[model samples]
Target: MSSAEGNLTWEPATRHTELLAGPVARAIAATPSARVAPIDAELADTAAFCAAYDVAMESSANCVVVAGKRGGEVRYAAVLVLASMRADINGAVRRHLDVRKISFAPMDQAVELTGMEFGGITPIGLPADWPVLVDEAVVAAGDVVIGSGIRGSKVLVPASELATLATAEVLPLSL
Candidate 1:
């Protein structure tokens, strides 16, 4: 993966946060090419981080947690889309999950289940059974910035590497 630019310092993602030290870290480590950079927690939001770090918005990706119920069973998913587009949660996600309805996960539930902060939820450390829907546009972008499972840092990795995740599915998930 390409190195992050601006005032950030690149390092193994595992070293940045406890959230990234488990399966998240393992996934990145297995890639052999991923890199993560530490940033001020205050700038973790996509817009602020991109502006402060001099990174283009198109180079960043957002991971959103979605929840849906089917046959009285609740299921969760993490949807990765470029900052430039919105995830089609109502259509694409609902259909993919085979549920009658779907919506953005509640902040408390998401944070609790994923062990991530409200805005720092990344696809990396999510529950193994949760599907990670990656937008085709994001996968085509090559190098992209993503959450580090914590607000204190961000990960720079190849979109292709994210596609390799067992729970990840690259598709037209954006509207």
Candidate 2:
């Protein structure tokens, strides 16, 4: 539970996928209409991973983060982008966040905060205080597939479900 769960620690599954398997997996599981599956961990690239597994690009939500200053505050904003669409970080995001100077957080910081390896930082399992900026496309589509805090695992979830799970703010993600 830590602070959020009142000092409770879940019995985590040893498998990378299992960490999210319990919660995220169960959420999608409730919807009998949706199909749930995982691709081989060997496949890492987006196009290859999607094609090999028959997963659509738009259904894949990429979680990206940037570091910079907003007024007197130093901050980090997490972004949810479609695997197919680019994040207009310097355009829509910069203006919206009112960040005077914005740049991608170094890989080290990313690993430190999220406790997940690079290329596996999903909105799930992030620090409770960090803002999970939900992309409009993701929310509009109603569901997304993102890294599950593990390189070899992913979770499929509805945007609304994710909003509640991460305590995220569903808003305009980018240009």
Candidate 3:
């Protein structure tokens, strides 16, 4: 069901509350431009999802959870960057987090904490304390496709809407 406006086969993300729970569902319901479309679970990866859905790689945002330690305390962050570039974890993110080192969160920790599949993490439903560091490029990408907290579907939303999230911080997060 392609939307007449974007000719994109996206349904309202809020329509699939069963699949996208917690903050993800609430965020979609609140954002006017958010949309969601079902896909084969196996095609949830960035490359596969883009190729199968005819989505531009540059317009696909990936949200990654990173972990680090500072003064015996564990810190976490959720980073949003386009598929075309990697998140600058050692540089931008570390500095933004005021931590000396950071790395991608362990798959188990990420999945358990976010309550989302590994390949389907999104900034929408992240823990409130986790910073949602978004790359400038992603914020300027207009409408982009993002994970929907489940491998079987994806969410589409305006970059501006993502920036409006309480934890969102737009910065040069890509390298």
Candidate 4:
């Protein structure tokens, strides 16, 4: 585990499906290196979680769902960026999605579509058609913290491994 990992005890994620959302548990089962740690649900947001858990902001990654619309058609995607940075939704992401407009997905739509808690969406188990855009910096961070599809726990995995997800594309996605 990275030194930046907080005080929570880590365990194999596959062995603790109850702590993860349905799709997340299934997806993580194929990732042998993934680890899970329980946390207070109230502190699930990036800043609060890092502060209360002694984790470094740079060692954490945030997955945001975005909606891109063009010609009356909408496309959804998941974007991963380090906690220290923000996804360039109107610039890189919009251009990459080839859409006329791009914005953060509404919370209810994101949660319902992803089958994840509002504050704990992760890129691991998104719908197959939605691309997972990973910031290049996140892939280079080594082991980093991410949401576990639920607000009560978190997942730890090698950043490089995320780039290997079938739908993932590594790009300069952050500002």
Kindly list the per-residue Cα lDDT of model 1 for residues 50-148, writing each as its tens digit.
989877778889999999998899989999999989989999889998988789999999888987777777888678899999999999987888887
Task: Go through the candidates in order and give each one's C-alpha lDDT.
Answer: 0.81, 0.63, 0.84, 0.92
lDDT of 3 by residue, 1-175 (tens): 2221233467777776766746577666556678787788998899987887778888899999999888978899999999989988999999889987788999999999998888999999888898999999998888888888989888888889999888899999899
TM-scores for every candidate against the unseen true structure: 0.90, 0.74, 0.92, 0.98
lDDT tens digits, residues 1-38, model 2? 11111111222222233544333343333332232334
Q: 78, model 3: CA deviation in Å?
A: 0.4
Listed per model in order, the count of residue pairs whose N, CA or C atoms clash below 3 Å is 0, 2, 0, 0
Q: Show model 2 residue runs off by greater than 4 Å.
A: 1-38
Residue 175 accuracy (lDDT) in model 4: 88
Deviation in Å, model 3, residue 134 alpha carbon: 0.5
Pick the lDDT winner.
4
Q: Where does candidate 3 have its weakest 10-residue lDDT segment? A: 1-10
TM-score, cand. 4: 0.98
Which pairs, if any, clash in model 1?
A: none
